[model samples]
Target: MSPPETDIAVRLSGVHLQFGKTRLRFDCAIGKGQIVAITGASGSGKSTLLNVIAGFETPDAGKVEILGDDVGGRDPAERPVSVIFQEHNLFAHLDVATNIGLGIDPALKLGVKEKAKIASALLRVGLDGFGKRLPPTLSGGERQRVALARALVRRKPILLLDEPFAALDPGLRAGMANLLLDLHRQEGHTILIVTHHPDDVRLLADSVLFLDGGHTLLHEPTAQFLDHSDISAVARFLGR
Candidate 1:
């Protein structure tokens, strides 16, 4: 059964993208406040799907609705979404607080209230007193936390992540996943994660979207996707 529009946080319908001979299509509805993982082999278009939803890549044909509003033709910044990437995308010249403040206003004209929000975000990401540090001085994991803090300050309804934890070590990755889970519980932002790690899928996602050859092969509950699915491709991928 289709969920009511209000209950859906994101919907991609009849989405199509083509590059050379490769063609891609996606159709899925993500429930409100759900964390869904996009998983696939290399060149399977997992990141491309995230790009489409983030408005970084335009679909040749499709409708992208966020929180029940059609966002087709909208520019990236105009959309109510925040994106965090694997590299963290922090500016080398900016301090952590200034870097995070950019999420609220790119011009950096931050008032007291905005500065308080930055402090709160830093504390939420567990870097309260480190906001004055430069990105280069921070460890990889700490930098990623700064990226997450930046995302939190953006206060968007939807958060898109493209391998944001891929560069971290296993322990750090797990910690980040737990932090993300806690943030989701507190903020309730619908999250879509494009990840290559099955452990990530197991730890963070409520549902899984499996892609192959640029097409959505399955969108199922996390348990079904991991344990009881009969899909041969998934079995092969998981080495079951």
Candidate 2:
């Protein structure tokens, strides 16, 4: 029983990217509403693959499709995706609500409806009354909550998280992971998160995409990836 094309949230076929000495080639299809963890050695192009899908980096070749549409020609802003980075990427001076409002409208001309949406998003991320606080005043976890809130407001069908919880303490990271899982269940957004933590993958990802030497070494269900660390490369990477 083959799934329909519409069931694929993201597809990268024969995708290729190059930067100086580093060359990347990727091919994978992630199902709709699934959470996929992208893991690899530091320079294995994990983030770059996300960039290519988000339209931040143009691939040298191949198709980049989102929800059955070829979005390779679209700009980052035009893509049906929201990206959350490790830095949180919040404005130092902007209040939390305004930072999220920017996601709805870059000009920040947030209307009544937009304001309500922001409020709802804040609540969804467990930061309801903290909207007036500045980014610097919030703890690292709180700041990442703001980022997640912002992504929620965008209402994109796809979410790209580039090690967004990497800097958080283990407790905070686990909290964020649970929050993310809750949000995903509610929103049904297809998520691709780049992370180095096996626990993160174990906790959240339905599948794992393992990159090595600028190529996809493996892409399999989380159970297979975690249970069978017998594969030499994955074993070495997982330190099993």
Candidate 3:
């Protein structure tokens, strides 16, 4: 049940962002239903790139399109993009199901069909019966799952994840990575995940975007990148 491979889910053309005197630029196109993993140093602009694509931050130059529409001028809500961050941006006051349902719409007007879809999404993320639990009561990995469930319920064509498993232990991180791959296959959503972990890139990425010094140095198939000497250099730089 892979997502339909028909169109480009995300496209960036000469995209550039700047902070004071520093600049970050990206030029790429990602096809529908593929997982693109971005890896780089802490301040290499990985998260900023995700933010720009999600329409949370406007690039200083170039064009961004999602689902065939130019979205550079659109607000975050106007773009068909969902982001899952390492912080698990769940409402502490709300229960899991409610948090996921919020992804439906802030207007609070979901039809019966939408409610059912939310329920299914929650189940898909292994939070089936824990929807009544608040964020404070959940473990780190469980909370991450909840955040992912929220993203799933949105059913957006494109998803952006910013080091969502950084807080988990090794075993837990691997499990989450597998779960992400499964969800990607089942829901057919185009996914972009940012991580410094080579294992994660090896396990989940269809392609890799290697960023260094605020620039994309390489974009290649995961296996090919692994065998490349440049990837080894990145691994050593990250102490991986």
Q: Which has the better lDDT: candidate 1, or candidate 3?
A: 1
Per-candidate local distance difference test: 0.92, 0.92, 0.86
Q: Candidates' TM-scores?
A: 0.97, 0.97, 0.92
For candidate 2, lDDT tens digit of each residue in 73-116? 89999999999999989999999999999999999998899999
True-structure Cα RMSD, model 2: 1.3
Q: Residue 140 CA error for candidate 1 (Å)?
A: 0.8
- How well does model 2 score by local distance difference test? 0.92
Q: How much does candidate 3 score in TM-score?
A: 0.92
lDDT of 1 by residue, 110-156 (tens): 99999999999999999989889999999999999999999999999
Error of 3 at 28 (Å): 1.1
How far residue 201's Cα lies from its native spot in candidate 3, in Å, is: 0.5
Minimal lDDT window, size 10, model 3: 1-10
lDDT of 3 by residue, 1-240 (tens): 222435778878899988888899987778788899998778888999899999888888999988888897899998998999999898999888788888998775878887787788878888788878899999999999998988888878899999999999999999899999898888899899999898888789998888888888888788877776546657674464
